[model samples]
Target: MAALALFGGIGLSEQKAKETLKNEALSGLLAQAIQQAQDICGSTLDKATGTLLYNAATRLKDQRRLGFLVNYIANKGVSSDLQLNASLDYIKNHPVDPIDTEDFERECGIGVVVTPEQIEEVVEATISKYRNQIMLDRYRFNMGLLMGEARNELKWADGKIIKNEVDLQVLNLLGPKTEADLEKKAKAPKQKAATETTEDKKESEVNGELHIAFERLVGAGSARGGESTNNVPPATATATAPPLMIPSVSLQPTQVSVPNFPADESKGFHTVPITSTIYIEQSDFREVTEKGYKRLTLEQSVGLRHAGYVISVQRVLRNKNGKLVELEATCRKSDMAEKPKAFIHWVSNPLMCELRLYERLFLHKSPEDPSEVPGGFLSDINPNSLVVLGDAMLDVSVRTAKPFDKFQFERVGYFSLDPDSTEQKLVFNRTVMLREDPGKI
Candidate 1:
């Protein structure tokens, strides 16, 4: 009967590899049906015969029938290739019965025999052909419920066997009640009296501490550290603390060297014990203007003042015959056109020229109001003040001096390094022009 059922579902044609997979799928279902039939009949087939029939069923090209046969063989201990040549010959010779035909026709069938080993081989081949697909089906069934005709087939074959068994055991234990009713009866409400007692104890402790803190805060009022006194009286304000005394540490006297000469001593005359007649270059003379005194920015004034005391030196160069020769010396603007005697007197005093130079190079009109005059405080001076290439002459030694080098130019006030210095020529900016008034620069 199992063989018959398995063969009944085997409806596949062998043509291509894909056809073989279809055969296996059908064989699996056929095998399952045959097994279910055998179980229902309470009859067991020879294991080898069952296997042979399963093998034959799996060789069918129809996947659904092949799958049923494969499952039947699996449950029935049956091999799938049982009587394959015989079945094929039988199928070939005998005309399939219509649904109306009730009896088997035995007259026209060919009886060809097939070995059990052949059945097993066929089953293995069929399974190997569709191993991956079979696995996918198994995984799908396990993950969810089987679907389509397979689901109906399963329902008919097993009749909810697993669910029935589970329900029976549950009913035996739980008296056939609904799950919700069973759960409700199984649970018991816990007595809350012990929990309430614990909560009350905690609440009482919290209340006691809170009451104490509240009473303390209210009673203490503004008093923070110590206990408050109810009888304390407000008193009139009065000076109660004595003055704080800081001890004085006397510092030792510092002997600071004082510059003995007056800061502005243009009028003071010292006799020249030795006078050197120095050459004066006409180009070295600059016309002194009232505006020139105002033009000195703050930085130039400080730079000039810092160049130190000025001294006028002049010399008369002489030929081998002892004849007087004219020499050049730096002079201010007003003295440039004056007679040589007047130039001599002006250059003789250095402090007057130094103060005037400071006024000319450092002072300037305030930027806030151009007309407003301001002293040349170094911090306020425009940085771009000095013009290079102004005429000047110096001794041969001074001519080789580096640019911006500090020098006391005779009769030219004080000079500082200028950018014009080179191997060929040296130039200096008159840092300050001599003047009589200290406030000018």
Candidate 2:
């Protein structure tokens, strides 16, 4: 019945029915065009964005029609003549580079330097978590980078680029495996197929040997100057394994240029790196002064806290001169158990310090108390929550500390060189207490 209505079965001919259907289709296309024009009526286009749209239109080969459409859009405030023209220029002038490469050649280029710590952490974590050939290969490359070798920025035939530094952080944070576990796994033999004949098994073994040889060739070629600086032992081969046959492959000297990496000057690439031994903040200090004693802000007491004057210090470990000589001893919990009695903290350098002592921010009252309402937590604000230790001691090293430099005081909490600190009078701000439970004696 619907088909008959469309064909007008009571009076319409076949030719007329076909003509009606064609007209309907044309009307639908026109409606869609109108909708598209309305949708793009009021949008601004930048050069890059305009170029993309213009290039797509150009592919349609309707140059005259496209020119009129561009003008109409520009006049409608959706685009501009300058932007469109720039895009047109870009489309005509942009260089086309080969995305896919068939080169079986190796290219060696200098990559970023990685720290020994970063390499150790990343390798340990990767070995434990993934333990695959691809990941292990990456770890080896990263190790080379740490040892001052330029890491190979491998560009696969399909255009995929493997950037070691980009993946280093994520791999480092993964839980690391023990060296014993890693060694055990490395020595483990690859399982063989149960149904395979001896001849097939021999072929598989030969293939495996060939793969190892191929890796060595690639690794050596990729290093440019010769063997990699990654001194770590091969994870796949056993110490006593017989030498395998090297596959016959022609060597070709070639260069593959990769995108230049962004500059990161803070990685100690061109500057001396400072390693922190300890960190003490205001929260770490016990009440050397009497509780509720007048707390003066460092700003308020800068004049009184003179050089060589004792502010407050406690003997943390066994030392006659009261100095932490061993860097590793600072991190040992066992060593902390042998700490000495409270001593005077002296100012070795001219320093203005604001020591903020921790106090209960709010007081809790019993539910049955007459004055206690549910929302009374705000009213119970501890007036002594912030005690400013204006007169504080600082070591001579504080002078060299740039603004915002964080370091641990001998017995205090982690403190930062305050932004307000100056060359004439260095200022230190107590950031936090050493312990989470500040009330603990």
The candidate maximizing TM-score is: 2
Candidate 1's residue-wise lDDT over 1-441, tens digit each? 343334433321122222223444443454554566566434545545443443444334333333333333444322222223333344444444331111211221112233322332333343345444434332111212222222232222222332322222222222212223323333433211111001001111110000000000000000011111221111100010101111111211111111111111221212211112211222222223222121111111100011111112233334577743332222121212221111111111011011112323222334333222221133223222333332222323233345444533332334454674565544445554332211222
lDDT of 2 by residue, 1-441 (tens): 443242332133344334333444322332232334435543333333333232223221223344334433433422332334433344344334321112201111112233333443443444344445423343322333432222222211111111232233323322122232234243433322121011101111111110010000000000001111122210110000111111211211112111111111121111111112111222213224332222211111100010111111222222466533211111111122222221111111113344445644543334234344222333233333455555443333334656665543423344456677766665555455443222222
Among these predictions, the greatest lDDT belongs to: 2
lDDT of each: 0.27, 0.28
TM-score per prediction, in order, is 0.18, 0.21
RMSD of 2: 33.1
By summed lDDT, the worst window of 10 consecutive residues in model 2 runs over 214-223
Predicted structure 2: lDDT: 0.28
